[model samples]
Target chain A: MVGTDTSELNAARAALVEALVRTGDEDRDAFRTVYRLTSAKLFGICLRICADRQGAEDVLHDVYLTIWNRAGAYQPGRASPISWLATIARNRAIDWRRRQARTRAVGVEDAEAVPDGAPAQDDALLAVEAHARLHHCLEGIESRQRAAIRSAFFGGLTYAELAVQAAVPLGTMKSWVRRGLLALRGCLDGDA
Target chain B: MATPDPDPDMTAAELALGVLDGDERAAALRRLVAEPGFAAEVEWWRDRLAALFADWPAVAAPAHLAARIEATLDRGAAGGAGGAANDNDHRWRTLAILASIAACVLLAVTTLLMLRPAPLPVRVPVTVTTPPPLIAAIAPTTKGAPIAAAYDRASGVVRIAGGVDVPAGRSAEVWAIRGTAAPRSLGLLPARGTARLAVPAALRGAMAAETVLAISIEPAGGSPTGLPTGPVVAAGKLSG
Candidate 1:
């Protein structure tokens, strides 16, 4: 198990709980802390769903606004704060994907591309650290299964679509995901 | 009959994977939540997939987006006239917010009503008239439900009716995916209300040739990419 400081975790949880309780107004500073802590990761999630930089950022803005408004709804025991945040991120990204389809009328030109750039090495390091610390459970799956799941989850392909993309039978692709999920569930359960 | 337990095919795992789109996904979600094991299954999937996001590329939003959010929040805090505009802006946010909530609520409702059949609310027959033979055929399909869509070949208009169940902060977009070419965006759809979406002219030929019609979740306006940047919620084959 990754060794996280118990005290630090407790403090973060306490603070989040306190923020939830003190609730007449939506707290900007508290939301800021949540934003600073989660934005990059949330952005990463949005990027996967939206498939570009600008789209992800747009989704990120909505996600934060949602988090700020929904802070009071957070339930600690049902899920960890990060899990809740991830849920929000995933939901926003999915919503963005659907809305884009509806807005463009089935073949209009998409918006401008999200800009591309190389980041400083420190940013890479931080992203790597964040990824590893948060996603350790993913490391347990077999490589091929991991690829299939990622293609479906991150790449957003249907099983038939994955079949075409991965050049495998639809059944095989489905099996890969099912087995992969079974393993992942076990791994995550172990972590918990 | 007691709603059968959600088969393995319709599990949240499948939903999160985008295996089910449009009515299939919606129907599955509606029925599956009635199953006792579905919630546990959804929670399991959420934890498993949360890590996949780590590999996603970064999306740096325009400063204006942040400014927009701040402005909305500030306006909301101000109340009165500013608050009214915030409320209007909030209508946009409501779709995404409500969509996620709707998904959850659907899950909950499925669980609650799984054993009981949903009441069929009586709906009045709606009549639609339009200029072209194609438009006349498509209009009636959109009248009753929150979402109705029809395509007219002569006018190259695909009329969409109804609103997607969007979450409080998110929005929905319509997507037209072509067979060979890349998928293109149509425009934003209403969150909870109904709207008519005009399919682009270029897509008319493709629609005649059997194009894929898909709806995805997007930011308020729509996605920048003509291709889908969000999960495909509902999808169908379009015929002119």
Candidate 2:
């Protein structure tokens, strides 16, 4: 079962990369193939950060359009295809939140109320080895630092927002996140 | 005294975490395009941090989303000739001819309007105020080949039909050159079938009449030195 799952994950990753390359060639069918394979994951990222279905849908539309134009710039060796796609989704969602912030305030209580623990379905489509490695590394960090990192990533909140929500000084929050990230990087690099 | 450079690793980590504000984020994006070393650093952070979201639950998007995306693509294609058809060489050739004639007509009308008396009420019947899209037919260095290529000015894209094969262990890179200027890289070309390459914004103004477009075979990831360090296989000029 373990072998099958690893192979399947690798196959899915390869298929996604191939589809993106084909889309670069302006193959409409390949574009459709890419959307079918990855839209769910991207939409989930958008929805998580945007916190609204309509906003997520709009951001998802822009994400695929960007993929259409920028697929040629994708280098397979630099990063996994899903990571690249997720990066774009997250950036768009964050930008949406930033734009909305000018007119409406994001409720600090509501954003902080989200549970920081690992979700049950966390490794469903991610590489199992990488997931295990990250979980292990995260355990080495303080709980507050870990929660701050998770909340910032999943909620697309800025350092200031994170600080306000945690009821900590802004500098304290920044140091916690920066130190946490550095430690996490050291651990991940050591494993490699 | 000059300001000290910010820490690259810290900046990359902040960017990867999505904690940078608007202006900071914009500056990071500019660096990602113009400074490749910085780009690689950013990519490293992204790859490392991506594992944090490995367990994000996958929620299926609305069923209509795919249809909506397809419709948007079709609407965009209808606006320009570049994305209209992939396999039809004849259609592209026809577009090139029409575009050429339109260019000539536009030039003639503009010249006539300039020379005519200011008070003349003679209104030209042409509604086209913009120059027709420049195009080119890329020809291989060797004899007749099935691959057809054209650049559409309106869409700022180079459309390649059919296939161009590179030898094993090599890749195809596209470059655009104007007059005596040095060739600018336009990214890599696909090995086969149709591909639409948007003209990079930095090089958009150079896509004019007399400019040359060429494809060279390079190492897999592309030319490492930013210059074409490979043999040119096919070349052409924007004709109209």
Candidate 3:
């Protein structure tokens, strides 16, 4: 919701949540509205993870269809509506990437990999309240955990993949993420 | 549901963070649905982790995607997606997909039927293979229907292509039979042409040069009993 003012953005956000709720009722019109408002953002996430436009398109299509079938399961509480939709897109993209990777001759994940700042490819500003909290807490944790968490979430990687890419043991990678998550929760909870 | 573990298994968190793979991923998925506390924890992890991606730079999707999805939705609403030929030729394109994915098994009659089933999400690839792939040409026994299946021992993927029309309110379950051994259910076949089935690891060994493959008509979800409870529509001996 690239609105000029906070009030307008809030209204657009509410509109999306309402539309998603209506989508549960099998309203095609409301589903279209949901698509119109969120497809671009979700498409971008899929594109980043899939690394292919056509594959991303196919993924985006599956994501929306999943939303259509699962809208009934969405809860207005617990999380932001946008966050909820974003989770579906991310999970779908990750699953798509994994399936393709497995089907096309499962290969070795390179040992000597690029550094952890690949997310720097996108310079978009964080636009939600949780964004600041997450970023702040992320900064508070150890750099290794922060980087591992970042790569795991954005890069759609598994502990095994992350371990191989970083030339570390799988247990080490898991420990980093597990400890980081506990620390992140404490930090965020302390703030809340 | 099992009481929320005392020390909180971080699987929910790992799942939310998208790092769990293979069995761990599958287990988390099962827990996600089976436990409310775990599910909420997952939602929590989802929200916090997803916040890291809130401002994914927006990119316009192709104009036709919405229409294509609408068509798929309509088809699903009419009847589920597979089994029927849709208006779009995408399925046909998928049917014609030829990527000589390597590995082999029982060979003779299954020679290149060009039995290409569309690539589907259901066919999970197991692992790399070195042995030759096996092809089973399942012909009708007592009844007349043509079905072809290719079994990759390495990957445990059984790609069944061709039509074996299922009677309404019933599903077609593929069975692997060897001699007097009881038929082992591979999985329910697609209502129409060309679909891949991942054979359970326990049943993968059942596929050999002379194993007999059969298809049976059962209740929608497959025979309630482990054994085929319906009539065998097609059966044949697989040859090398």
Candidate 4:
């Protein structure tokens, strides 16, 4: 979260807000322009999570139509329009995540046009802190519980798979994962 | 020991986070949906997941994609152009098809009558070979309308052996009986000699079918009113 300002974020935010505000009977062209502008980037976010280009493109198409229809529902000041739009993209991706089979592990090589970049010191530190917080929060949990949560969140492994990996019973792995997530949520709430 | 109370809807957040799997995940989502509070928690998880993807960089869209969308919009805007063209072609084709069918029906009726199973010899009226001169003998009763000559139905033919004299610039015209409407033009009669006219097969039924076959004489150009203007020189039954 270091050096993340409200102002720079607000620039992307303002464009979307203005677009929604100006979206009326006469502004169909504006809506189309916005769709053309944002669809590719939004598609990228969906593809990363879905790991299927076709599925990502479908979600992207749906998201734009939804945005066009619901533009009047946009409330500025609560969140930037771009942020709102991004939220829409991400939710669609997450909805797709559960449907995708874990057997298909998407290689990074298969992803199109992923940028290679050196992580800035501040960005890397923030990422490290987030990971550390997650680890520290799991420190008090039993090994089985921690393993269950990690398998679910990062590995995309099902409880049955996690149980097999941990050499534990499936039911126990499920209970551990569920309870572990609840406990972690409580701990994260405290940190906030 | 107290009974362990099972929390049915507690896993909704997990389901929303994609933490549940198979039947368990399905049951969790269903239960969560059943309980309002759990559903709200799931919604929260959804929003949280949504927020994370906001960090990704926006990519520029490909030009061809916009073109494709525009093309789709254009095709829709043309209002069923492809279907309209198909229907127009289909309409003309249908009309032509119907006309051919009508002509076929007419041909079939004539063929059926000719091939009647009994093969009874039809009696036809024969023309009198020494019939009186058309103008002097038959003109008054004809009321100046062209004479309708009767023919033999058995013979199935008509041969006009003589012509009536009309004043110069006036031509004798022939007609086939076609009921109450104006008569159909057969052709021009000779000024002072015999003229032959081929009787049409459909006209075989003219007299018996209660159809009156009459002819009218008119100016050289034919009847403008489509009715006779000249005297009926000769008249007879078409049947022989």
RMSD of each: 15.4, 11.5, 14.5, 34.6
Question: Which 10 residues in a row give candidate 2 chain A its minimum summed lDDT?
Answer: A115-124
Off by over 4 Å in 3: A1-5, A72-79, A105-127, B1-9, B30-36, B80-240
Predictions ranked by DockQ, top down?
A: 2, 3, 1, 4
Better of 2 and 4 by TM-score: 2
lDDT of 3 by residue, B30-69 (tens): 4543354675566566556766665466789889999988
Candidate 4 has a DockQ of: 0.07
| Candidate 4 lDDT over residue span B6-51, tens digit each | 4333465565455555456545533432344554455444433333
Question: Which ranges in model 2 have alpha carbons more than 4 Å from their true place?
Answer: A1-4, A72-79, A108-110, A113-125, B1-9, B22-37, B79-240
Instruction: List pairs with backbone clashes in candidate 3.
Output: B103-B133, B104-B132, B104-B133, B104-B134, B105-B132, B105-B133, B105-B134, B106-B134
Residues A1-192, model 1: lDDT tens digits? 334455565566566545543331466766655655566667766776666577677677666655554444343333245545666677667656655544443121122122122222222213233335335655678877776666666655556556666677766776777777677667666666
* Two-chain DockQ for each candidate model: 0.16, 0.27, 0.22, 0.07
Candidate numbers, best TM-score first, in rank order = 2, 3, 1, 4
Compared with the true structure, what per-residue lDDT tens digits does model 1 show for residues B56-111? 45544455655666776776665421332344454344443434423332222222
Chain B TM-score per candidate, please: 0.39, 0.46, 0.45, 0.33
Predicted model with the maximum DockQ: 2
State each candidate's chain A TM-score: 0.64, 0.87, 0.79, 0.57
TM-score per model over all chains: 0.50, 0.62, 0.56, 0.44
Q: What share of the true interface contacts does each candidate keep?
A: 0.23, 0.41, 0.47, 0.17
> lDDT score of model 3?
0.64
- Reference-based lDDT, residue B16, model 2: 71
Q: Compose the digit string of candidate 4's lDDT tens values, residues A1-192.
A: 335444544555566556665652326677775675467667766766566766676556545544543443233443334445655676556444433433344442233333322222222112333434554676766766765554444333455556666677766666677776677667756876
